[model samples]
Target: MNFKIFPALVLAAAVTLSAPVGLQAQSDDPAAERIPIMRSNGMVLRAAPRASGDEAIAAAQTFVDNFAALPALFEDPAFPGNTQPAAWDNFDAFVGIFDEARQGAEAALAAAQAGDMNGYSAGIQTVAATCSACHGPYRRQ
Candidate 1:
């Protein structure tokens, strides 16, 4: 084989082999595009709890049900990559914090929908505890 032609073919083969690998890795990423959206929505919703209520309580219930997705925001995509910055620490701790809050939110929404004043009050307390506990640990000034 001619040296020049051999080098060119080798380069071409390498590129062909690498392109799909890169695309496959990207496409398979579980966190891709999810973490940022979750993070943004968490901030937005927390800032405006009233937004959670503006929709009919029925619609709010649906939103509250999906709250489990919130913790994805703080996750680092390139976790363990040497060149990447540190990912958020204690994901399980953060999840516990958010899960409590999410449950309270769901409970509150449910109570409000049922028009149960006592349940609503209790739900509010639960929600407050959830927010304060998580915020105490992870929220920064």
Candidate 2:
């Protein structure tokens, strides 16, 4: 019950619990890491159009944050197994899709904040389309 020992133990336990989840997402296999993020974003994007302004804003924020995790997950040579080599060949364009998605998410968030639900819905849908644009040519069977 010593105060010093108690806080240290709590910190240690939290780190112990978190390390595996963090490490697993950073695993060598891109698919393992990418699939969950994609699914989560898909859920948000799918529901965002029907969501209220506040809900759409929240979804957009989640997408903005999620963007940070994606770029590092794919590289030129070693990428998600489902990714076609064409993505690497047209790497700049491929990367631009992600940037465009993030920007669209940001626009959605801004529109929701400004009380423009129509703009918000449109922006969110545009962001969702980025997946198809990238995957159409870039995803292998």
Candidate 3:
């Protein structure tokens, strides 16, 4: 899974999400259900200090590939899960979390491609930290 396919995946998700909807809440939709799973599974090996460059790059691309559309999914008011009001109150900062994650993943990909496994590992940490960044203020727990 190359990062080149990211834009197309995001575009497709946007198109799918933009379709007409009934009054029902989207909390149970497959996309909503898949978001957390993706986030968890996508980073399962992020903490591995010695994963091969190939493995690291593969993980980075997989994250970018699957996560490109999450912002759109999360933007839906009726999406699943309890979002803290501060997320909407400071929406730009909330969205910045995703931006940071994407940048980190991209940097990881670049680092792995360049045979810099150390930087790739650090970039994975950068990517992982965004979860805490967003969750601190944007997730109800």
Candidate 4:
């Protein structure tokens, strides 16, 4: 018997027995109930910033990604279990910031495609504004 498989089998049995009808697994389920606002922010930063080659645009993208990835430093199960992070508690606080970030990303991508460095710069700044807006509230010291 494969020892590696044993853990999976046990986990499955535990899930089958303990899980409620509507309850979902966080890791296995594709539509797991993550904070959508946070996800959108991440997408905006990662996808939109790459749309341009301008230094400021790239810097803005890098800032958001680096900051957002910080939460995973605590939340990722691969890390040792620790206290819950603030992001988990303040999911709604950053929704507006993410919305703005999304728009900026869209604009940047469009500008980058059009070879409009000015547009790209403006879009990246817009995205950075969003990230900064949210960070002002929930970001830690």
Question: Candidate 4: deviation at residue 69, Å?
Answer: 11
What lDDT score goes with residue 77 in model 2? 60
Which digits, one per residue and each the tens of the lDDT, describe model 1 over residues 1-141?
A: 788799899986874453232222234443443444334335534543443343435333433543555444335445322212222566676667667767766776777677654665565566556655655555543
Q: Rank the candidate models, highest TM-score first.
A: 2, 3, 1, 4
Per-residue CA lDDT of model 2 for 1-141, tens digit only, reads 899799899986874453233234456676666776777687887788888767777788777766656665666366547788887788888888889998888898899989899888888888988988888898885
lDDT of each: 0.51, 0.76, 0.66, 0.51
- Per-residue error for 9 in candidate 2, Å, reads 23
Which lDDT value does model 1 have at 107?
76
Give the number of the best model, judged by lDDT. Answer: 2
lDDT of 3: 0.66
Clash counts for all predictions: 0, 0, 0, 0
The regions of model 4 sitting more than 4 angstroms off are 1-93
Query: Candidate 2: TM-score?
Result: 0.75
Instruction: Please write out the lDDT profile of model 4 over residues 76-133, one tens digit for every residue.
Output: 4333222234445654444445556656766765666567878887877786676557
Error of 2 at 52 (Å): 0.9
| Number of the candidate with higher TM-score, 2 or 3 | 2
Candidate 1 TM-score, true structure as reference: 0.47
Sorted on lDDT, best first, the list reads 2, 3, 4, 1
Give Cα distance to truth, residue 141, candidate 1, Å.
1.7
